[model samples]
Target: MKQFTYVITDEAGIHARPAGLLVKEAAKFASSTTIAKGAKKGDLKRIFGVMALGVKKGEEITVTCEGADEDAAAAALEAFFKANL
Candidate 1:
């Protein structure tokens, strides 16, 4: 498994558009991806799950990836967050 912690930078937070983009990115990997915030953890490939995290700007979150291609998934997700929050 691979994990990365990131602070959301988007002013609007992880709203519908960003969440959808995240889900779309997660779907490209063979590994299972999850986004966690506080006590909540949800599948990264699911839009609702991503939105349900209620991730706000400047909030820290951890993204974990497991199974084959986890490294790539983690890297991609980290890059996505860095670029899009």
Candidate 2:
């Protein structure tokens, strides 16, 4: 498993568009991706699950990638977060 923590930079947090894009990105990897804020963790591939967390701007989130493609997945997500979230 690989993990990293990031503070959301967008004012709107992980809203609809970015969340949808995130799910699409997560689905590309063989690894399972999960993001957590506080005690709430959501599958990165599931839009509703991610949105349910209601991640707000400036809140730190921990992202974990696990499985065969964890390294790639983590790297991709890190880039995605920087570009999108």
Candidate 3:
């Protein structure tokens, strides 16, 4: 598994649009992806699951990936968060 942390930079945090984009990006990888805040973790491919986290701007979250494409998944996700929020 690979893990990286990122802070939400957008004012709206991980709202519908970005969350949807994240889900789409995550789906492209064969690796299992998850996002975590505190002790809560959810599948990154599920829009509702990501939105339900209530991530806020400046709040940090950890993304983890496992399976065959874990490294690529982690890099893509990191870049997405960096570019989008």
Model 1, stretches more than 4 Å misplaced? none
Per-residue lDDT for 4-77 in model 3, tens only? 99989999999999999999999999999999999988899999889889999999999999999999999999
Whole-model lDDT, model 3: 0.96
Q: What are the per-residue Cα lDDT tens digits for candidate 2 across 1-85?
A: 9999999999999999999999999999999899999999999999998999999999999999999999999999999999987
After superposition, which runs of candidate 3 have C-alpha atoms over 4 Å from their true positions? none
Clashes of each: 0, 0, 0
**Cα misplacement distance, residue 23 of candidate 1 (Å):** 0.2
Model 2 residue runs over 4 Å out of place are none
Error of 1 at 69 (Å): 0.4
- TM-score, every prediction: 0.97, 0.98, 0.98
Question: What is the lDDT of every predicted structure here?
Answer: 0.93, 0.96, 0.96
> What lDDT is reached at residue 20 by model 2?
96
For model 2 the TM-score comes to 0.98
**Model 3 has how many clashing residue pairs?**
0
